[model samples]
Target: MPGMGFGIRIEGLSKRYGEGDTAVDALKDVNMTVAPGEVVGLIGPSGSGKSTLLKCLGAVIEPTAGKMTVGDEVIFDNGWKITDLRALRRDRIGFVFQAPYLIPFLDVTDNVALLPMLAGRSNGDSRKRAKELLEALDVGHRAQAQPSQLSGGEQQRVAIARALANQPPVILADEPTAPLDSERALAVVRILNDMARQFQTAIIVVTHDEKIIPTFKRIYHIRDGKTYEEAGQALH
Candidate 1:
């Protein structure tokens, strides 16, 4: 039932650092919208505002100005509307980093299940949902294995599964395929695409990997704190 409204929307978003005498603008009037069940790409070079945009969307940092809406609610309009940012991040926004960042101490199932568990779901229900996500991601056979025992691709898949465990309306993936070869990178993108469609989650993958860049249906290119939108080949 998540993603009931527009998946993610941003308008006139801007972020500034420091005081007026030494202010640095990291984002300038950026606007974007990602619909439910869509997979889009965010591409930019170093110091190009991609990180700032991601942090703002993830609620890790606040923006100087603009609006952000997710699903049916407006999270920010010039300021944060949600008081419980921790719960918002935990329950509504999922993150996938370049590294797997799995809890080395926990098995695959537990790693994926922890999000829902923290969100107040019963352990039994959380683990069941985790197992189902693992099966969907093709990592169900390794449910009992620790992070160290899995390959890079499998670890990424587990990370993806963890991101989706909360059924968040929006997923933010940061350089997810930077560590893989062409084949494995494409495989990861395919899994992300499948997951987006299956769950009706809007996904934005921030990546520099050229191998999978051409696979996006749409792309947002950021440079000098501004973004340009373009269409890409919708490769499966």
Candidate 2:
């Protein structure tokens, strides 16, 4: 990976599935850019290729064409510049889904530490990093608690800590507030914004929740495989 700033940029990105006659164009000339410490919303209806775009950004799937740059490094242009997709994802991209998705057998500390551990860090160092993140997220009190013992909000906080463990430049969050009430949902967005600024991380949130939509400073609305950028009201 080349040394670069903290952000992600995508230009003319497109994804296609199947053969010519049976082909489906999932994304068409999609363009997006997120700056470090900024939180943007990615809103789209069902079957609008939101997931496809996420997968491409996450390096879970290869795009058929376009350019993707993480910070100043060109990760994908026509084809991936780096050979190890798994390592690329693990090292550069963080992800938060609708559910907490914590490991059932591990406690909160170990759950967040698992990412660093998988990346070859020593157990002690990984746990140390996890503890710091848990403290930052205000979940340090539950560091020893099992996922089963945690409240929904606590579990989600731990999940956010895990995503920030590596201090990745970009985090892709998909409907992270879906399971929470209005208050908790707004709380999640607040946390995301705070974390982004604190860590200088760029975050793109994919959501359909109307309650938090107005909270974004900028939003990308995807429909029929294209994206339109809009300025948001950005609730404080």
Candidate 3:
């Protein structure tokens, strides 16, 4: 749904572990929305519900209660509205983990093309699309290089390209630059902002990295099962 004027919409999203007195509420009636082409940061300290919220939104775990929509698809409502979360995740959402996690044996192009291939696209079309994203992300020159041969930044970029391979409406990036230096971290953030704008993808980045925290226009800080939305100052 690129440039389709649609994005993530969440309401009363909640999650809990266990039950009754032993239950721990990881999320508490959370509500938020992100527009198309927008980028926001999700920040919180250890033991907070940052990961819990991400898991809920990513469809990795079911919420105890809530509603969620990825782009135009209502994936969850009280319970899941869709039977196949894996398909929804693959077709409508994208994800970037703390590490690039690129397959060691695959070259950069194959690492990205793999997702489309899994989705049943032809190898030629998948590789063509992969090359386009690699070029857009400025990693085209290294398309033939194996993951083992790339720098930290290059690996992260490849991971991002893979996430975009499906042209998903939303992308969840969990600590994407945690392993990079200050300069490299900032570079990742800059690239994220640019890519969100270019592709009209809504991006939510979960991170504890202090260096790029203030760069977000808006930040959702979760603590003890609650969330506090705050405005952030831009970096120079």
Tell me the whole-model lDDT of each prediction, alpha carbons only.
0.95, 0.92, 0.89
CA RMSD for every model?
A: 1.9, 2.6, 2.0
Residues 1-236 of candidate 2 have per-residue lDDT tens digits of 11236499999999999987999999999999999889999999999999999999999899999999997799999999989888878878999989999999999999999989989999999999999999999999999999999988888889999989888889999999999999989999999999998998899999999999999999999998899999998896
Candidate 1 segments exceeding 4 Å error: 1-5
Ranking by TM-score: 1, 2, 3
Worst 10 residues of 3 by lDDT: 1-10
- Report how far residue 125 has shifted in candidate 1, in Å: 0.5
| Residue-level lDDT for 203 in candidate 3 | 94
lDDT accuracy of residue 56 in candidate 2 = 98
- Find the number of clashing residue pairs for candidate 1: 0
Most accurate candidate by lDDT: 1
> Tens-digit lDDT track for model 1 on 1-236?
12456789999999999987899999999999998988999999999999999999999999999999999899999999999999999999999999999999999999999999999999999999999999999999999999999999999999999999999999999999999999999999999999999999999999989999999999999999999999899797
* Residue pairs whose backbone atoms clash in candidate 2: none
Q: Write the per-residue lDDT of candidate 3 for residues 112-225, one digit (tens) a residue.
A: 998899889999999999999999999999999999999999999999999999998899999999999999999999988888888888999999999999898878888887
